[model samples]
Target: MAKDFHPPYPWQTGLWQQLRHDRQQLGHALLLYGRAGIGKYAFARYLSQALLCKQPHSGHPCGECASCHWFNEESHPDFRLLSPEQAAESDDESAPSKKTKKKTQISVSQIRDLNEFLSLSSHRNDGARIVLIQPAEALNAASANALLKMLEEPAPDVIFILVANQLQRLLPTIISRCQKVSMPAPSESQALAWLSEQGVQNAQQQLAYASGSPIQVVNEQAQLTTLADIWQQLALGSKLQPHLAASMLIAHSAETGIIALQKWLCDLLTMRLTKQVHYHIGQSGALQGLSDKVNLSQLMQLQKKVDELRKLALHPLNHELQLEALLVEYTRVFVNK
Candidate 1:
């Protein structure tokens, strides 16, 4: 995190205070978790810094301290960040799958490498050292077991803070070794107000489109506009040109386009079976028009195909052609009986 980065969101203030109040009582490892876009990772970072700071004051770290400078520069000798992307590179090896692509799992080799760091004492006298692992779910079966060993025999003066978007995805045994901190998801009003403060117009629309993740709204504003265009193409049903639509979607990513379609079709199915739609509340008219002409059996088959494609989205396939084929099938669902 940069020194100029914004503080935690308003909803996090209370939780921050709680952590401060129980600062001294904190365990060796902390599992901070909540839904995606709730700022759990940021909170973990803030806590890591505060704990490592040589001069903490008034419930926060003093940024002027040498310790703070080292942390901000990401060169603190005692501080380590264990994230999937970082782990893959830190092991002095390229990803076995794809050199450029990020691996989702934290390798066991990375966990074992921590033995050297854990063996050392803090760089500063009596000051805490922190190891922050984000999205703890990235620790697969082997990595989780390796981590479990460390948790069982925790090194003195070293703290492990694990941040996760999905706690259920983590190993239950690993979870039992740490203290769980459930981060709060801000209410819709709070999110919209925050977006408004950030000078984001059409806050409600953006927030809804992001499934209430304010961070995603801020990060993906441009993509949202592209999504709107894609939705318009999707509404064309039988008239939609597969190649053109596929190009636009593949430009973003195969996974992203598949997810967008999944969510849209989910709403379409809801609109078909019942008169209500959960996501894409703003695109009801277009979805309603498509849902009527869609054959239920074929729509179900298309959804299954999309799910399968999503599973293989990372494979080295001709993305544009695959999406075009899916879109060709998509148009068939609207054909007259």
Candidate 2:
């Protein structure tokens, strides 16, 4: 019995049918590539269910079989999933505990674990093994090399599915070994429609901030949305209290504050240079006044600083100090009145 799995909306039903046919012929390795939050993970899960289905149906899982139930319960012996830890501490929290925990990255140790797990015989006495590596590019050099070795001499009856948001970040050897499944971002109209259906009122505005990723439109994180609103307010050159607004924005969504700040500032700087003063304060506004007030050279310099800040945010070291510096720089730019 296959698990009762229904595909997510952004996925193509035709592709699902084609995959079912390919599986019959034993496709050993599949690379599912696409923009993040566009249903790649859901599709990967669907394929896992289909492969483990005890009672298959209509090129999908039957959802009622013993194997399917175990899969849904996440107790399937032959199924493996690998993902990065979501919570990495701020520098303030990290310094005192520095020796206790290492910074998070998919390292060789994890690959070794995978190798050991896959070495054993299947519990179902079937030759199938399903392993998913998400954000596959997270694999550091040694880890990726270890994976390459596995790919070179893949186990009999084993299937590896690599899901990557940024395919270009993956190593060439890794890219060369697997069959690629390219997934495009949904069409603009399609994304907009889905966002509206999800009850996003300012869908177009947020869609612009998302740069076409519909998942951002439906992002449940209030801070991500509020971050956009802050940017909208700033770009509009609003008279609101800067510290109060910034504090509220960061308070609600500390998770993505740096990223949101950097990206929004970049876009604002771009507008300043292009002199396309139409701003999105949850609505587009005339830029005539903002265009005159902001200096093009200052905006260019600020853009470079933001780019450097982005690189700094990637490192786990000095996170608090770095965030503080970022806030200071932003204050200098927007609140130096």
**Candidate of highest TM-score:** 1
TM-score of 1: 0.92
Residues 227-328, candidate 1, lDDT per residue (tens digit)?
878888988988999999998887777778878888877888899889777768778888888888889999999999888988887676777888899999
Which residue pairs in model 2 clash with each other? 1-54, 1-55, 2-62, 2-63, 3-63, 4-63, 277-287
Error of 2 at 65 (Å): 3.3
Q: For candidate 2, which ten residues in a row score worst on lDDT?
A: 277-286
lDDT of 1: 0.84
Please give the lDDT score at residue 23 for candidate 2: 72
Taken over the whole model, the C-alpha lDDT of each candidate is: 0.84, 0.67
Q: What TM-score does each of the candidates earn?
A: 0.92, 0.81
Tell me the TM-score of model 2: 0.81
